[model samples]
Target: MYRLTWFATNYDVNREVNNGRGPVDFKISKGSRDKTLVEFKLASNSKLKQNLKHQVGVYQAANNTSKSIKAILHFSQTEYLRVQNVLRDLGLSGRRDVVLIDASPKASASTVSDFNQKGFDF
Candidate 1:
């Protein structure tokens, strides 16, 4: 969420902005310019495909901006692959505004298990 906070200094950042169609997770703008709609989702969300195809476009239109961004976080390999398919289906695979963050615990996360077995808290 550091990026979101960082964006606030130059733009008016609004949360859960409803534009008659649905709520946009974030609406960012600098005065009357550079309006950007941002939506976030878990990669496991079943409605991800549907929303990306139609809902985001409508939000951009309603917000009167041509720029929009979608951020998805994946908690597993399965979720990451599913997002790839959906991005291809929506022709957003190459779009710069669509962002995917891998949130899965890394293999390194278990490297500490050996230390834990020795009852070390640090």
Candidate 2:
């Protein structure tokens, strides 16, 4: 998905890029001087705390760029709270560089009848 989005643009996106330090999830760059690292993780991951602490910094150093983004997906409310706590512990709360995605399943709009139907003409 990331690759497809950046494919048409001048940016180049690569996954699991290894630069000696270790392989990062994704690397988006237009050139050596313009590079950004993106790391994806699950909220339920066992190493979530450790990864949130030291992973991105190492990747940035290895890739020679200080710019990076961390994205974590939570499947439930509990997982979301857990991620929040972890981020708080790591002093990264409310940071724009860290993205928290809620991937929990939801009921379809058609199946949900709580909407105001007065404006519709079915």
Candidate 3:
């Protein structure tokens, strides 16, 4: 599981994610100055990450702004570094930067949480 690092940053207000076949997870904006392509991935399985990179490419094509897809960032900091390393080893550029951050405390966490369910932990 992973939580978004951007969410922890100071925010103006909560925003909505446009999921009409766009490349990233959600649209995060910094005031009116910048926008980002935030792609969240928890299970960096060989198959899943490979597909995500492709999705990043498509995501770039979908956006009409000049800001660029900021990053194809995976937020599973505690345990997925190896997989992230492998993905970086491939050298597929253009908005790919795997990030690591302590997982966010879930609003409603199960006492016995798996910590790998794909969101709310990173």
Candidate 4:
């Protein structure tokens, strides 16, 4: 969770804002009063696949803004591939409103070499 004060000076950023449908993750208001909705997700469960298809769009309409961002963090290669496939399925793979981040720790050269020795690629 982020504190509003972190971005209040630049933009009025609030978390867990319920516009109508439900509580959105965050909403940041620009100088023109247009709100930019942001949602964060961790690729952990099966439901994430279904949620990614429409959650952000629902929040955007509820918040009365066309601009939004869905920030998804992948902690492993499996999670990363799942998100990638879901985005491609939803036709949002290259959309500007989507922000996918790789949060997995990198494998050291030694670790990669060990994997290669075992006929695996890292």
Candidate 5:
């Protein structure tokens, strides 16, 4: 998705890029001095806390960039709560650099009669 979004732009987006320390999920660079790292994780991952604490920092240092984004996807309310707790413990509860995506499987509003009666058309 990142690649597709930045396809016509100057930014170059690569996946699983290894810069000696380890492989980060995605690396976006416009030039040698312009770069950002993006890492994706599941809220249910066993090492969610550890990764949220140290993984992105390590990747940033390795890639020689201070900018980074961490995206986490949760499949359920339980998993979302777990992620929230971990983020709060790490003092990153509402940081913009951290994005939480709720990908839980649920009925769409368009398919719900309540939404239809409310004049919401998907």
Candidate 6:
């Protein structure tokens, strides 16, 4: 997993190798005093959402961050725009200093349309 604090003079960035099904990315803390959680997926997978939910919920609770822990889903291309949309609507888009990066411009737009048309919950 990778851990990094952004927009700071000093930060922590750690990349941990995955052993099985686990995270490989990092999330900036809601505040230096608060806790953060993150997950990175290079490919689009339906199970990613479930992982997101758990991270934002159970994981946050476990960490005891009442200020709403941050989350980042690093995708390589259109494979993850679906998740980005949900994050955007929730005001978690990169424009808001939440989202991390885009997988691909083409796939990003297509993923949005595809998700909307197929009624998939990104």
lDDT string, candidate 1, 1-122, tens digits = 63567553866888889978888999888888779888998899999999888988898888889998899999999999999999999888978999999999876755665775778776
- TM values, all candidates: 0.80, 0.88, 0.45, 0.75, 0.88, 0.41
Model 2 RMSD in angstroms? 2.3
Q: Candidate 5: minimum summed lDDT over ten consecutive residues — where?
A: 109-118
Per-residue lDDT, model 4, residue 25, is 85
Candidate 4 Cα lDDT to native: 0.81
Candidate 2 per-residue C-alpha lDDT over 1-122 given as tens digits, one digit per residue, 9 for 90 to 100: 76687767988889999998899999999887999999999999999999989989999999999999999999999999999999999999999999999999988777867466646555
Q: Model 6 reaches what TM-score against the true structure?
A: 0.41
Q: What is the C-alpha RMSD of each candidate to the true structure, in Å?
A: 4.6, 2.3, 9.7, 6.1, 2.2, 11.7
Misplaced by over 4 Å in model 6 are 1-32, 67-77, 84-100, 105-122
Candidate 5: tens digits of C-alpha lDDT, residues 3-59: 788878888899999998889999999989999899999998999999989989999
Q: In candidate 6, list every pair of residues with a backbone clash.
A: 1-16, 76-103, 77-103, 77-104, 78-107
Pairs of residues at least 3 apart in sequence or in different chains that clash in candidate 4: none
**Sequence-dependent TM-score of model 3:** 0.45
lDDT of 3 by residue, 30-97 (tens): 66556555555554444655755576556545653333332333445534565556556666433335
Provide the lowest-lDDT 10-residue window in model 3.
64-73
Model 6 residue 98 CA deviation in Å: 4.1
Candidate 2 residue 92 Cα shift, in angstroms, is 0.3
